[model samples]
Target: MARKHLVTHPSTAMMIRDTKAAEVAVLEHHERLDGSGYPRGLASADITPMGPILLLAEAFAYWDQLKVTLSPGTAKALADSAFAFADSCLLALQKALIDASPHTTPAPG
Candidate 1:
């Protein structure tokens, strides 16, 4: 899928003091934990922390906008589905981070 909106990354980064992080977040926000998302197909480990947050916010805004055109029940269902997908991706990303963390040895009592 050609995501034309991805071009906003550089423009957004140029306006922010934290250019790199902002750029990465914008670029990675569409990525999924299962590598099923667009532009890069990056997995959980590859995505930045802000990526998931942006994805969730975008999903909410999208569904919220659709509420105007869709029936209440349909809108609610779509919102729930979007939230579920975001939750699943977040959980997978959390798990990936946990798995990648270095184990620390406790001090002897």
Candidate 2:
């Protein structure tokens, strides 16, 4: 495929084949934790830690680009939805945000 051909980074290529951690995370970002994804129907435990983070980051970016602001509560609810996403990564991201913001109060979980 063009993707495989266009990638020139030896390290990245090796990561794609050998470990597949980064590849699965990025390439399979759209995949849910419940075996409801494309390219491959991978489920929880099958998905790596990075996958959830990458997927949430992508969602956040897209929402930002569209000027659609989600309240912390709404975002937290979506991330906490075990039926749709990975909770651990979302909680980590929320914690990071809370830690980074000096003035903003931490939202209740």
Model 1: per-residue lDDT, tens digit, 17-68? 9888888888888777777776798886777778877776675455444432
Q: Rate the local accuracy (lDDT) of all candidates.
A: 0.63, 0.61
lDDT of 1 at 37: 73
> What tens-digit string does per-residue lDDT give for candidate 2 at 1-109?
6345224433564655555666556666656788776447678777776766777787666655555545578656786564366666656555655554444567999
Give per-model TM-scores.
Answer: 0.57, 0.54
* Model 1: residues with Cα > 4 Å off, grouped in runs: 68-109
Task: List where candidate 2 sits over 4 angstroms from the true fold.
Answer: 1-20, 80-83, 92-109
Q: Model 2, residue 47: what's the lDDT?
A: 71
RMSD of 2: 7.6
Q: State the local distance difference test value for candidate 1.
A: 0.63
TM-score of candidate 2 to 2 decimals? 0.54
Cα lDDT for residue 36, candidate 1: 73
